[model samples]
Target chain A: MANSIPAPRAEGLHYLGLRDDIARRIATGLLGPGDRLPAERRLQADLGIARGTIREGLFQLEAEGAIYRRDRSGWYVSPPPVVYDPTRWEGFISYVEAQGRRPATETISAELIVADPLLAGVFGRPVGAPLYRIRRRRYVDDRAVLVERIVIDAALAPDLLSHSLDQSLTDILKSVYGLSVARNQVSMRPCALTGEDAAALGVKSGLPGLHVQRLSHDAGGRVIEFDHEYWRHDAVRIDVDIRVR
Target chain B: MANSIPAPRAEGLHYLGLRDDIARRIATGLLGPGDRLPAERRLQADLGIARGTIREGLFQLEAEGAIYRRDRSGWYVSPPPVVYDPTRWEGFISYVEAQGRRPATETISAELIVADPLLAGVFGRPVGAPLYRIRRRRYVDDRAVLVERIVIDAALAPDLLSHSLDQSLTDILKSVYGLSVARNQVSMRPCALTGEDAAALGVKSGLPGLHVQRLSHDAGGRVIEFDHEYWRHDAVRIDVDIRVR
Candidate 1:
């Protein structure tokens, strides 16, 4: 890559508190994980300094895990990422709310569909078991964000279809069926939006999206429910509370 | 969000297999998050079905956390999300690989700049620390992507600017300083790109981006590094992995 050097600042590798400069860059959002630095020759020429000073600065940043250099790809920007603690099984709604963003939903088309092999496995019923389904679009303000369809065990939630679901299903289960979801898992992957989804959300197809799959269990370890959350890339942040091992 | 009904499949809901249909919509890019499904009344009219049947179909989909519904504005897509396990400390190289995507980097700009107070506090160094600042750009493929820079820990990484690097600094620490990182706290917030970031990523400012901040610690619990990763809104996906209690 060609150098896009701007007005030369202080040049030279002489150790005049270089570590603080590097540390400062990180604090102010300059350097990130997975970024690369220029060759030593160029750096020395531009900074007008010895190599030792730079090495010392890097050593400290490295110790902190602020930057990581691959075998060949150079240094990179590591986004502040949230950790998923498997021991905490709250649903997606709770996850968003935990981050202090309001979570809201709209009921879409609700209908019954015949289950297939996979649905059978998730619902834990025979193939072709009668399954109740609801398709809803979720959002943050004007952004028509995630489009999700939920499946229910019709037998388990007989009158579920008639109820207004303005709150959380887990809450509904607790109030109606005396069930408490004790744990859940969320898995995600990079995804692209489709024409139908685009048309529904008024977005163009091929835009990046996050596909989230969640599975929950009750206190007795019974599979409570499983759902997929198709979230827009821009409107959400998943937060995690972590502890050092 | 407008309600775009799920067109009845050629074989109807039974043959389409409720589970497979949802997955296909996501995988084939047919349905997207935030796309509102047709109103139950409209869906029945368009799909030539009873309203009650549509409700049953939607019920199952909601249980899986695939979508969120609002009380008034209709259903929207879930935003890009991830369930991360923070118990283990990791660099970007390992993290991206785990997601089944390749991460790459390039040098952007690097030079010494006067330390500001905020940076000085982060590094635990006195104010106005002279640092060897390095800026780098990162990418997934040919996409002109994220731009990141790092402020070296002026004391430990002496001569870090002297070496040609595009590799993992964690590895460098293991090989050179013998310092190992063991913990970190990462967080993210949604933001618009700055002129500098947007220009580097080939986009205009005011577009959305993920602004992340992290403080990294060492084996002895010393906070050794701080990091910031700002990603273009269109090109990145943050996966949320959760383990629930």
Candidate 2:
């Protein structure tokens, strides 16, 4: 351990140097988005620095959203986070494309299920009422960034599961079901990803994530859909504008 | 290592049972907000469970926001998060009081500084312009939960630094300077806590946190204040209402 230690100033420089080197590499396109970083052992041998110092530098980069770690796997450069404005009624595809990034969605599962007590309350239906539950994994530039579970009131859109579930649910609701969302009640918090969400996002369990819950209502004030989204903490930014008269 | 291994089902039960037992304790008032939990060794010895199992249970509780770790200090129960509506102009004290919690602020530092290029751009002033910088730590129910750094254009408020900064800056600007914030542009993202912020919040560095940045403007659309805030991830929930016409 003593032999591994470098002088304080030298150690600081080494870590900061590593962090800046990687950042510059990413900025210069030497390291592309989602490119895996070299293994820690390799970095240590090449940089001739302690593994602890290298880890500190990587953690700093993670804090800055420049890179992210996968459980058991190495770190990867992060893509630019998409700026999401909750005030806009925009689909994920439109926003991602607007930001010059490719977007894709994979339908994990879709089925009709009996509404639970909470779901019934949200939809103003009886507990036994039918609801279409859809789960999806959304990708930005070929890296899975979000997993969403949506519960839609089935009575409002019969055969909803028959439609291609890979596209935007908002667009599908408007085009096929003739229901346009007029309002959204959005709640968000920082959370730790667990189990299925972690697996879907290809990250380790207990990684930090952003949990967003949205309740979409039609012009008539009827609740049409409830969506629960878990996003990689580095994948998106939430923007809101408020005007007070 | 082999001695620490329990049967698979028993290990699952041990950890889940520990998690639920602690949650029940919290729900039943056996444990209160900010109350420190027993040491890991103490819990392991008392419950006759492996230390690894106990750690897993505690991590689960942390993910649920039922408790939080304090670096070298043991875990403590987390207070219920305050609901923050960024759309509202309500002050911290008003909302915290409304939710039956005490709110306090301590001015960590206040000084006048020369604006850097970033600050100059934000304020639409030259890089050498003088600005007032204020750093404050905010508390909810006796726990430090947020640290905010605010920069204000000195020309707008002549004696801004002379005023008490422990209270609401919004109220101060309105009452003293007769300037009302008519608009706010807010951006938020999940982040990892680092050096100063983590120290102020009494948590370990690299803890997950919520980072919020706000640009406040008056009726004339002049940027009045720029605020950067770091909050304990479990300390608050952000709620936004979007009306799409």
Candidate 3:
């Protein structure tokens, strides 16, 4: 076989052409972490492109974790976030640092949903009991790579919604309410991401995702939290050290 | 709102079309586990259909794990098979039986191959050292749902190829060689299936698969096996009861 191998497919990077410029500047050590990116209008004017084109490029860059944005705030360069090991079952913070990836949580949505038939039994509650459906996305290196939905019994966890949803739920449960995933019945499967999940994960629909569904309980086996994790395939691997069956 | 709403999509099994003859037979208990299925030629004579139509029916049935075929061995009514838990890192027999499914091993391929760059480190040998690459498909509910490739270091396991590839490697190592997966370093991710995997799993390419890559060793950390498990999306779950890091 020829020793020279063709380079990796370069088709998708064109959309992020300007993104490369920004990344190159960062890599060249000219711009450091926490440095702000130029505004869309200004970048467009400088680059001789339309504002919409610049906006799309910015979106692509943000999706790739090349930069970060604050709401009504500007995009900023950031370091890579930490990774969460699903197997370590650590609270979010420790796991992030362990993987040497940056980690951030943004509670995008939270709602009080009526526990319907299936969820009622799972949460060990009566039908129509109030349940907290908390939605959050995790960022690693400024790239949002995973989305999660935590369903907790509202009556039991009165302060569940009070805690920072953008932060680690594992921490909230322990520090705030003395709850833990003392025992979890977890099931993982592979699935093609739906349009909604794909958007949350910053990947295309029809791409693979790891569906981690858990029924978490207290030490007494009292059910406490129902967590659903939608994980990106590329950036994370669930490392399991299985000592027994 | 109406007391009952039609599903936005399929809630259960309605979308899965089951012909009356097939449905009735299963429903009426005329067909049962481990029973031989009528051959295409025989079914054509009995049901008065073209063989192509019969083949299509078989494909659907296979998707549902209602039927199975052996290579040149003919089709047989399927019995429920158990899913082996890679995450649990248990012996094959116990884990399978505990899941309320049968465990059957039929070794399709086994041979000694020289280790490559990556396998060298995993097997604790130099590149080009002899190793056994064994291939197996794990069945759940009589449906073959997983394809596994296991590499064994010949130094630790001389005459490895002589053992029945159909027997559980874990068992052979424990009983015959007194080795086992006392501790496993497993990394799992979601991936698309390969063409060979698709053929073995009776699914087309692009189907989702769980890639469970693992390093198994004894208490002293001598690497015994390096395994790559390609699993069907719906069949197995990677679960762990973790002590938080």
Candidate with best TM-score: 2
lDDT of 1 by residue, A97-182 (tens): 66654567778778877889998887677998787787777654334667876777776667776777655776677788777766
lDDT of all predictions: 0.56, 0.87, 0.68
Q: Write the per-residue lDDT of candidate 3 for residues B165-190, one digit (tens) a residue.
A: 77677778888887866788777766
lDDT of 2 by residue, A1-245 (tens): 32343333443566766777887899999999889999998988877888877886787687567899877788988878998888888789999999999999999999999999989999999999999999999999888899999999999999998899998888989999899999999999888777779988888666678999999999999999899999988899999987885
Clash count, one per candidate? 140, 0, 11
lDDT of 3 at A154: 84
What DockQ does model 1 achieve?
0.11
Q: Write the per-residue lDDT of candidate 3 for residues A1-245, one digit (tens) a residue.
A: 11222221254333255666776889998888779988887876566666765665665455344565655668877554333455555766567767776678888899999989999999778999999998888877676778888899887678577676876777777777877766666666654455578777755443445677877778777788888888765455566666653
Q: Candidate 2 vs candidate 3: which has greater DockQ?
A: 2
Q: Mind giving the per-residue lDDT tens digits that candidate 1 earns over B1-245?
A: 11443654554553123334554666566768557655667756665556655554543343223443444545433333332344455655566567665667676765666568988887777788765577777755444446766666756666666665566656665567666667666665545554577677765333445666666667776555566677655455544433443
DockQ, per model, reads 0.11, 0.58, 0.24
Instruction: Give the 10-residue window scoring lowest on summed lDDT in candidate 1 chain B.
Output: B76-85
- Pick the lDDT winner: 2
Candidate 2 positional error at B238, Å: 0.3
Q: Candidate 2: misplaced stretches above 4 Å?
A: A2-32, A43-64, A70-72, B1-32, B44-64
